[model samples]
Target: MSTPPRPGMESLSLILLRRPPNPPDLSDDEADKIQQAHLDFLDDLRAAGVLGAAGPFRDHDDPTLRGLCVYRTTLDEARHHATTDPAVQAGILIADPITWWFREGEIHLA
Candidate 1:
């Protein structure tokens, strides 16, 4: 047997993170500090169950920060929460809000 899709609608999503087109101009010490803060933020999100996955995307020799964070709520909610993240507050990321969507294979209702 196969599972059926849920009726009605599902939650909206947003991806908020920073990605430099080129290499960052941060000193080694500054980089370390920012990285630590980013890790800590991820920890917080994971604990909250709002973070499905996250990581950086490197292209060529430039170290561009291409990361993703999945939030289980509407775009507005995601944006609000993301803006409050320590990484965003630390100026480490030029957080961009992108609204996206996906189909749920099976949704459990209580």
Candidate 2:
């Protein structure tokens, strides 16, 4: 049987990154800049030890479902981080924060 979670342990949040249905028309340069900014944001999160994992969905050609970011933070904080993304701030993308439950040490990097 699986053991219960330890005290102080709680669920995290996963930001579902998606392209807006009616995305604003942005110049190629502007789009590139936003993309770069988003990358930089994720990098910062990783360095801050809040980004559990982040990557794009390459299984199909679904533009709406772009990627996801697993954040080791509260829902409010995760939402704030998602909104701070340049792409989201620029209205190029949208984010939906989903609660995730898992063992504290279940996830690890090699």
Candidate 3:
């Protein structure tokens, strides 16, 4: 009937990347450049110890769901990083981050 509280939970940000309406049509070169910049941003986050995991989805049911970013930070921080992403800035992708709570040190990415 009632749920019990769980201890040792960590607050994380789960960013859901979606397709932007009226996204810009870019040439292959420009698209590649934006992608590279996007990767660079992720790398920067990783170096700063803010990013937990991030990657694009493949063969998924939802077409709008492009990728995701799990951050070891609050929603505000994750939003800042997502909005500043080159891909998001270029309208290649959109980022919507939500708070996620899980057992600390339970999930790991390789």
Candidate 4:
């Protein structure tokens, strides 16, 4: 048995993170710097309560599929936030919105 979703909950947006087909070649230091910037970007979103959840994918069917970001906003808003990430801007990671239907209260990030 499972509990059904309650009424009146808000919807959340989802964005899938992936490695570009032809990701830019960068030195290890450059890559690390971009990664750090990406983390800082996510932290900013968290502080602003825009990112409900975000993380990297360890094992996936497609190796290029890197991670996911669940946003507490509409699809457009989510896209706006994701596309602004330093990694995405640098072509280190790409973001694609995926339609995901779930009540907002269903997820929370500490």
Candidate 5:
């Protein structure tokens, strides 16, 4: 049997990164700028100890699986962070938040 979660354990949020249905027509430079901004945002989160892991999929053409961010934060805060991404604000991408649960110390990244 699985053990129940202990009280006061923090919950995590998973941000499902996806491309918008009708992405804005942006020049290469504009797209690069937005991408950099998004990276900076994630870096900040990592520095703040909120971001656990984040990365994009290999297939850029895939509509369903674009990228993801697993963070230690409330759902509202995760949504706020997701909306802060320049790509999301520009309608180039969308972030859907989902509450996640995992055993502590089990999820690690290199």
Candidate 6:
């Protein structure tokens, strides 16, 4: 018997956050503290599967992180989760999330 086709995955929204510019007068310690808090928040999101990947943008020297997250259900849920993230709560990151649709090709996520 032939295998049945897999069900389609719904398009999900992705949240992208960028770190604020560092003040010329801000101390390194202060920056470290902020980063730590953001890390803690990301840990929570990872546990919840709301965050796919969270890391610093390595295209150049800066505190910006190129992040992406897939919402489990609806756009609202994704927004709620992103807003509640530690980085967002601590003001370490600001999110501009966008909805995206994708189809599985040779690789499968299921």
Candidate 6 — what's its lDDT? 0.63
Model 4 stretches astray by more than 4 angstroms: 1-10, 103-110
What are the Cα lDDT values of the candidates?
A: 0.64, 0.85, 0.85, 0.85, 0.81, 0.63
In model 6, the Cα lDDT at residue 7 comes to 54
What's the count of clashing pairs in each model shown? 0, 0, 0, 0, 0, 0
Q: How close is candidate 2 to the true structure, as a TM-score?
A: 0.82
Off by over 4 Å in 1: 1-12, 20-25, 59-65, 106-110
Residue 94 shift from truth in candidate 5, angstroms: 0.3
Best by lDDT: 3
Instruction: List RMSD in Å for every model shown.
Output: 6.5, 4.4, 3.8, 4.8, 4.3, 6.9
Ranking by TM-score: 3, 4, 2, 5, 1, 6
- Choose 3 or 6, whichever is better by lDDT: 3
Cα TM-score per model: 0.65, 0.82, 0.85, 0.84, 0.79, 0.62
By how many angstroms RMSD does model 6 differ from the true structure?
Answer: 6.9
lDDT tens digits by residue: candidate 3, 1-110: 11224777666678999998788999999999999999999999998889989999999798888998998777787898888999999999988878766677877755
Instruction: Please report how far candidate 3 places residue 44 from its true position, in Å.
Output: 1.1
lDDT for each residue of candidate 4 in 46-65, tens digit (9 for 90 to 100): 99999888998985589899
Candidate 6 clashing pairs?
none
Model 5 misplaced stretches (Cα beyond 4 Å): 1-11, 59-62, 103-105, 108-110
- Model 6: CA > 4 A from native: 1-9, 20-26, 60-66, 104-110
Least accurate stretch of 10 residues (summed lDDT) in model 3? 1-10
Provide the lDDT at 82 for model 2. 93
Clash pairs (backbone) in predicted model 3: none
> How much is the lDDT of residue 21 in candidate 1?
50
Encode model 5's per-residue lDDT on 1-110: one tens digit a residue: 12337743435688998887788899999999999998998999899898889999885667666899987777888888898887789888889998866666666644
Encode model 1's per-residue lDDT on 1-110: one tens digit a residue: 11224444344465647654544578888878878877887788778777666667656464444576666666666777777766566666766766553355443322
Cα deviation at 25, candidate 1, in Å, is 4.9
Ten contiguous residues with the weakest lDDT in model 2: 1-10
* Model 4 Cα shift for residue 64 (angstroms): 1.0
